[model samples]
Target: MVSFQQESDGDPASKPWYELGSAKHQGTEVTMARILQEQYPSHSLVLAHDVLYTTYTRFSILSMPGVEVELVSKPDLVVNNSFKALPRSAFVGTPGGDNVSAELVPSVEYGGFKLTWKDRHFLLYIVHFARGLSTNTQFFLLHDGPEEPSHQLLLAAGSYQNELHDEIWQFVDGFWQKSSGLWKDIQSANWDDIILESDFKAAVKKDVYGFFESRDMYKRFKIPWRRGIIMHGPPGNGKTISVKAIMKDCSVMGYTPLYVKTFKNFRGDEYAIQAIFDKARDTAPSVIVLEDLDSHITEQNRSYFLNQIDGIGGNNGILVLGTTNHFERLDPALSTRPSRFDRKFLFDDPDRPSRRLYVKYWQDQLAGSEDISFPEALAEEIADSTGKFSFAYLKEVFVSSLVSLLKEREEGHDVSFARCVREEIATLRKQLDKPQGPEVARNSQLAMVH
Candidate 1:
């Protein structure tokens, strides 16, 4: 059995030597494997290493059933020469709520721990080395048993991570990470709450639902079972909410939603695009939401993005739903191409009736509030006064009005909520009359060019 010794002395000569610095020059796995073999001569070593952000192997092992992990108190060998710990933050209550708490994850940077699984002893070392600008984490397992058990342990840990529940896979920083808060945010996004024209709403639903349900239909027609839909218009006109509703619906239909926040990462946009679609293909029959599609698909990565959309690797059962506020900025290959983004839905500024419906939706929300008297008729008045306003601007008006009303109450002065809302609307309307910014000017130029 491997016996424990005193912790590493300050002297570099006395301390154990590891090829950590040379990891950048050589294969990290090979270096770690060599170190493990030298340190644990009696036992066989199994090594698993990946970029720190890509996997949850440690957490998966911790949460595994009948598995116990104990940190090695006294280690004869300490590679990287220092002990480190960092806190893992978590929301205590509701996600995005005020309550946040963090727990110290011991020895995450570099430490040794013993894992007990199935009444067998296995020594494990969790170490991280800086690889260029990123950190590469290595998991070294030493056991006397046949390699199959250790291999099974690693495989089970990975499989546990792939089985996600109440989580949405998000592509950020060139990796696909899981975000439960995003899933929670979309839970309340139902189709009934979305205020679009009846026919328009139905069409959007059919576009998404029909594609997922008609996999066999696509096969019958001898076409690829992949689809792309673009939602484009001015900012904050039901585009985001509609996408969320679709995400929720897709989850209900047993399809995963993979949200891509941006394509800009350390490796470059090309790498990000490849990683995003790779995950989408792996989790086939999934929804890939490219929010702000115009910003993500630029001249640099346009061809790569198009190829991935209708690429040789056959994106079967994958649906790409892209949203953009600046439709004019999108390339013709993306906006007009047939198989790339097959359909484009314009979420233009709400018409008079749609605006009225939105106001009524807000009115109903405030009906039970004693402080805000948002009567049914007030909805019509506000909608009539707010012309050429996006849903976002209207929301700001309502929010600012309510805040002002609260301030008035706090100051021992009473004011009518209706008057406050009307004043705020007038204020926003004046702001809207101001000249457009340079970005808008550029978009207009591009629109003319297109």
Candidate 2:
């Protein structure tokens, strides 16, 4: 047994053996080495990185998570650089203080680890394990030292076979909490529950994921792999929930959600933005969510924010999704420029059909709740009284109505409370929807001047 990268200059790129995986690759040589050392703790194990050619590469056609994105490998050897493993166990110091157990082993960076298994004549085991946490296992093997592809072979790792990596983050107290830090348990209301406009869903499908799948077109057109979306319109609409749904859907395609609570959370606003984008780009094909775009990306720090997104060699595979109540107030750079936020989907008041469906969605949810009666005609009655409310408003309407009905039920009042709840919701909507009076606008201007 010997160390593959035993007597080499620190320069890994100099080698002509093989190429490296994309930045998206998970496992590294250090990880493989750790596992190898643990498996044969007593035995002096030879450590080497395997170069996976076409033939030796493994293909996992069927698995729990079928056809995973891992450095695949099988039991095979390359022709040119023949590997000769000695049965005798020994250790000797090599150059750069990295002691080798045998003679020359393959030199690699972030690839699979090759080591002798049993007999002297036994061929090398080139394992390229898919390195991730999930029930859908890869038996992830390794390859190059720190800059190459790998395959899953040889070593039999135990419980690590089932690892689940939760990739949702939050910015809290000036630092970005990595995936494990924040609320990993995400419960998104069923897509059927949220009443979204027709065009909104269609455009999002074509704009975001379509853009993602069509990466070849981007390469041909020489465009960056980043998309920005502005989900605007009323406050209570399905903006926030819709964003969560996007995150859940995008996760299937490997787009982790990174939440920016507020610029105020950052110790320094400027560095915070840089850190956010840096992490986003580091783990590309990620979703950077700014729930309140106008509030966070204000006029004061908008310039710095713009520079972060518009920097040279702009973000690749980073989808910057922003939800703004005040769409017009958002910096023009975010909306005016096509590249910055290519799409703007409004969560306007739900139309008649949408409102009816929204109530039906609630009815389906409340079907089992025997506390109150979600009568058949109640859906239309509520929709008629609400007068074109947003998803959020409709939600509030049902919540308030349900609460009122519950109170009536406790008091042994008639179920007719639904009508009162409906009337009250209509009245509440009118007050919230009132156009800004002249005094309010004038005072806003005066406050700004000060």
Candidate 3:
């Protein structure tokens, strides 16, 4: 594959080597060069004084301009410092739904730039000078090659980059599973939508928004531009909703969302932690949403998981937002450590005022309904009656109430929406106070997480 054009200036043993890529290699020489021009560079640096240079003889007749070149190591760059290598082949279809014939050789990661002059379809790896002098800096070029290429390299680098940006994955068992489209569903609630303790809301707002704005501050402090947050409490309260709000808010600010369903999804792979951390690094400023964080970390992989957070490979701009119903189940090292889950937010069951606010929220949601509307006084009364109700139970009161009305309407009886709403609240209180069925226990469990 090496075509020695001539001795690399003054270094006789270090000859400038060129290769004419065929159907077998990374695109045709020209095709690879074209693709390389669009590659999101992995790292960029300047070549200063005392760097090597190999000038091509064909361009010797032209004015000896200062040689310049560009190098891109990754297929995509989602955000700043968010760059990574692509795989050699893909079983998944491209965004365009076409058969993607991309062969992104993970090993063949050298930056490239195109050569332009005299209609010559070729790739020339020239060098340039920048920054200050250093022995580590290097530059070189290959001159000799066939005038044309056999075929274009089918490296769908562009497509591959696009796919990862739009969708993320969990390597559960052998297949990739898509979970938590939280970003898209953020429209369901905003800061004004959820009813939480005011101080809690203020703190959450400040941390989430302030973190993104203070990235430079993080750098100045020589700290990683990353944050860890834990939302814990009984299920059916507001942990998941808060997490979604964070997801939506972060998305508006242009951070990518990463969802990890559980630790067991990795299925005991030695490299799972590394791979997970690597993906987050490649997509910096990403919100890693890990549901049930407490149960995911067992004694077996706890140490390994901890290493990834503060390890040498820890990435900047990563916001680790985890939600857990059981705080007692989590390790103190994970929940208490400032470097791991720095801040913990408790989503407790609704208090009296919160219960009242919950009723108001439902009223706001149903304001446009034509058939019936719950009055402001009635709403407050409903809130008073449901003092101990979680947001989940409050939601069910309305839903079950509507179902009862539907049944009455179907049976040709007059539907009294107000009566049904009030009755459903009383019925729910009794049912919750005295639970018996195994199915109800399972449903209660589901409601808590819901």
Candidate 4:
């Protein structure tokens, strides 16, 4: 394979290719940038920047605003312009470096399309707008070198399939609706320092007050009376539990809880979400729970999601309670919106007060037994033991430890709180030794202490 790039010595703009009628393209290289700018106006195009001198000449013509065409290929063949007009040698130092077993192969077809390969051939895809446009383009080289590209092809196909699914979603983002049946009677309480953290309790009070007060002020302006709260944390740290507790608190303060998910179990059935939001708007005093928010709406769906949230035909009286493990990955525009999430709370593991409360709660649940009694020092130990254990893990710790103790007792051995604590510590010690799995360790620690 030989490659050639036309270059003028004096000026680039004076080149023959730059002339409107001099160098004409035989077939349209698909004006993707123009298509994206005209069609998907919301997204911007990002070009792949891996191609070199020879490759740039062909793709550069297609580059435009909000559109970037990049050639994802290897630089295996070093062109020596000796005899051939397109002076590039393919056989002798092929793109196949020491990392790959396959040799470099080059071919030309499809209106001057060149295929240069090291591990496998990477066909150039002209990307118009870069907002998660899925295509049947395979990514061969993952960790520097490449092996067989069968897996890469599979991944590309899967990605394209997902892209097709996303295209269907753009249509559904226009309207606003919600279901009234989504509301559930939540049980909330003014828990002691043990059951609830100070910051959490403080946020609850602030949001509850803000909701009513803000409504009175916004009524004059005709803006819907609504607010949003974003709760983010590691998994099993009791995000769901905190939501349940928060909903209960909201109900006690004379508010209803409306729960919503982005998608239903069945495909293309998002009417439930719309219906729920509609009810929340009509219900006046309602708190909406949108669990796993990141999963439901991501950066890819930002424009559509924003349309539903604050775009035309939006909802009011809806306090969106969203939970996510990865808050940083959320769309920047969504986070920046004051109307979207006015209050953002991050749920870390239970501190000393929370740990003590969990222990007390578990002890009360197992109160009939004379063998286990809650100790103050044991509370501190459990608190220390649960470095990042969530309330969910704390409950599991109690259950696992109690079950282990009951088994030992049935086997004719005396089991006490001391034994349970020891068993819990031993479990943590074992987890600390493992090479992977922190969630498992955290859960183990929670079971041991709580």
Whole-model Cα lDDT per candidate?
A: 0.77, 0.57, 0.57, 0.50
Q: Considering summed lDDT, which 10 consecutive residues are worst modelled in model 3?
A: 150-159
For residues 324-412, could you state the per-residue lDDT of candidate 2 as single tens digits? 88887876777788778887877666666667777888889888986557787877787666654667767777777777877877898
Worst 10 residues of 1 by lDDT: 441-450
Q: What are the runs in model 3 whose C-alpha is more than 4 Å off?
A: 1-171, 174-189, 265-270, 434-450
In terms of lDDT, model 1 sits at: 0.77
**Residue 341 in candidate 2, Cα distance off native in Å:** 1.0
TM-score of each: 0.81, 0.57, 0.60, 0.49
Clashing pairs counted in every model: 0, 37, 4, 12
Q: Model 1: residues >4 Å from true position, as ranges?
A: 1-42, 51-60, 63-65, 74-107, 131-134, 370-372, 434-450
Task: Output the better candidate (2/4) by TM-score.
Answer: 2
Output the TM-score of candidate 3: 0.60
In terms of lDDT, the best-performing candidate is 1
Worst 10 contiguous positions by lDDT, candidate 2: 441-450
- What's the distance in Å from true for residue 170, model 1? 1.8
Q: 1-450, model 3: which lDDT tens digit per residue? A: 322232233222112212322124432334433433343132122221121221111222112232232222123111223234434454457789976454342211123343333433223333221222311222222333431230111112112323433334443442333434433455586778777766767877787778878999998999878888887877788777777777766666777666766455334743556556776787677777788887667888888888887756766888877888888888888877888877777777676666777777788888997776578878877877775577888889989988998899889988777889889988888977834222211111111221
